[model samples]
Target: MDAASWDERYRGAELVWTAGPNRFVEEELAGLPVGRAVDLGAGEGRNALWLAERGWEVDAVDFSAVALDKAGRLAAERGVGLLRTVCADLTGWSAPEAPYDLALIAYLHLPWPQMAQVLRRAASAVRPGGTLLLVGHDAANLEHGHGGPQDPRVLYTAEQIAELWRPYADVLRAEAVTRPVTDADGSHAAVVVLVRAVRK
Candidate 1:
């Protein structure tokens, strides 16, 4: 969807997504050292707020100002105040001035070319030895997962992600992981792929 579309969607009171960090984000980053981090397409700042609570200074970027406002309020209500919110389109946005220890891009669906470009830029934002983590609806999500963007052009595979990051980083892990996803009917189904890499 375009920025205008997303803005209107988030302008409503439905809470576009759950108010919790993705399970893969929690699992992969749990034991890592806290440091400067960035959450791209950080809708509602779930991952960003979670990182701040864990002692990481976070920069949360999204195109929708409405979502950022909601995220800011959520951070304040949680009593953890380390998040910096930025409203910008990822396709044209630049990274933070300083290198980050970790960069997270979770469920930020975009066209294949755009996704490749953005992921490459995100990889560059990490410092040497820093980590770059990505978790999103795998291409299989359309067939096996219950919820996510219906367009396959935005969905990715492990192989595609590996190619996206291979030029600038060493992929520490690139694999398709099955995680349980509950449908509107409350039926459980498997969804998502989790890919991670460390700056070289």
Candidate 2:
């Protein structure tokens, strides 16, 4: 969707996504030391706010102005002072050099080439020894899992992401992980590709 479309989607009083951080984001990053971070495609800023509350200075970048506004308001409500929201299209946005200790990309679906560009830029923003983490619906999710985009062009595998990060960082973990998803029918598993790496 375009920025205007996303802005319209976010115009509702309620948040589109959950207010809390993504499950995998918290599970993987909870123990990391506090430092400067950037949450690319940071929808409503849940992850950025969480990092800010934990003493990390975070830049939450998203294309939707409405979403960023909601994020800013939530940060104030939570007394989180270290979060900054930037409105920009990730396809053309550039991260400020290798200054961040951590870079997060969660559930941002785009075409393969554009995604590669964004991920590479995100990786470049991380300083040496810093971390880059990505989590999104795996390609296998369409047939073998539940609840995610069904488009095969956008969905990717862990290996594809791992290969992209190899030149810039040392891959630490790369796999398709299953998470529980509960609906009216009960609990079901949803497969997601997760990649974590440390900059060389």
- Candidate that scores best on TM-score: 2
List candidate 2 stretches off by more than 4 Å.
Answer: none
Which regions of candidate 1 deviate over 4 angstroms?
Answer: none
**Model 1 TM:** 0.95
Candidates' RMSD to native: 1.3, 1.1
Deviation (Å) of 187 in candidate 2: 2.4
lDDT of 2 at 42: 95
Tens digit of per-residue lDDT, candidate 2, span 1-200: 79998889999658999899999999999999999999999988989999999999999999999999999999999999999999999999998854899999999999899999999999999999999999999999999999998788888999999999999999999999999999899999999999999999
- Candidate 1 CA-lDDT value: 0.89
User: Residue 172 deviation, candidate 1, in Å?
Assistant: 1.7
